[model samples]
Target: VVDRLNLQAIVPSAQTLQEQSSRMHLKKLKTVVTYWATRQIITYNVPPLAFIIAANTNVNTGALINLYSDLQKVAIEDLFNKS
Candidate 1:
């Protein structure tokens, strides 16, 4: 299922992390485009180094909202429930 596929993707990245001496950590970057209630699209970019951590860690929604708020006005409900 989805979990297995996600794990398969993580293994290689985990090895890379170890080999890199743990100096680097994972981060997930997301980009969103919204058009005044006409359309909304969200895109996620997972760096190869991040796949391992992503498989295990839950993203912090509050932090993401704070990060993206500078780009535009972000509503908590819109982000969490996608309404």
Candidate 2:
């Protein structure tokens, strides 16, 4: 599941700039689905926090650990049910 995480946010600026130089361009961007798990306490009043970070950039060790921890809270049945 970790391997399946969409890491598109990590595209290098240089690469993006180069791509923009080409004739092709993105007309629309959309996210059909997104899944994230976090260990932080879940609450009824507060909403879950989901953030997308660049893969090429250095991810804070603490943030990465927290993400993995949160992901564990998701039940296997629930995850599979999403499909």
Candidate 3:
């Protein structure tokens, strides 16, 4: 089962970017992330922590790692059941 959303669809293709140019690809990805964040699609604390973790990366590396572990707390069945 697809327990988690496919992030690749949302983020620019890493492989494609590498083929073109790593620097350009990274810039594109950063731009996309900045755009998404500025749009306020993923606001702070309004959505679940899971959603915040998925969208934002300004958090510290250790915090991010902890948040990722929280993903395991979400059952696969719950993910499938979400509308």
Best-fitting candidate, measured by TM-score?
A: 3
Candidate 3: worst 10 consecutive residues by lDDT? 38-47
Q: Highest lDDT, which number?
A: 3
User: Residue by residue across 1-83, what tens digits does model 3's lDDT show?
Assistant: 34595655544444543454444354333121222331212212211432332344454444444543345456344655895
lDDT tens digits, residues 1-83, model 2? 76886544333343443354342333132111111232121111112432333321233444544554455455344556777
Which ranking of candidates, highest TM-score first?
3, 2, 1
Q: In model 1, what are the clashing residue pairs, if there are any?
A: none
TM-score against truth, every candidate:
0.21, 0.25, 0.29
**Per-residue lDDT for 75 in model 1?**
46
1-83: candidate 1 lDDT, tens digit per residue: 66556544334433443443333332223432211122222222322111112322244534443444443333444455764
- Clash count per candidate: 0, 6, 0
Candidate 3's clash total is 0
Candidate 2 off by > 4 Å: 1-54, 76-83
Candidate achieving higher TM-score, 1 or 2: 2
Superposed by TM-score, candidate 1 places the C-alpha of residue 53 at a distance from the truth, in angstroms, of: 5.3
TM-score of 2: 0.25
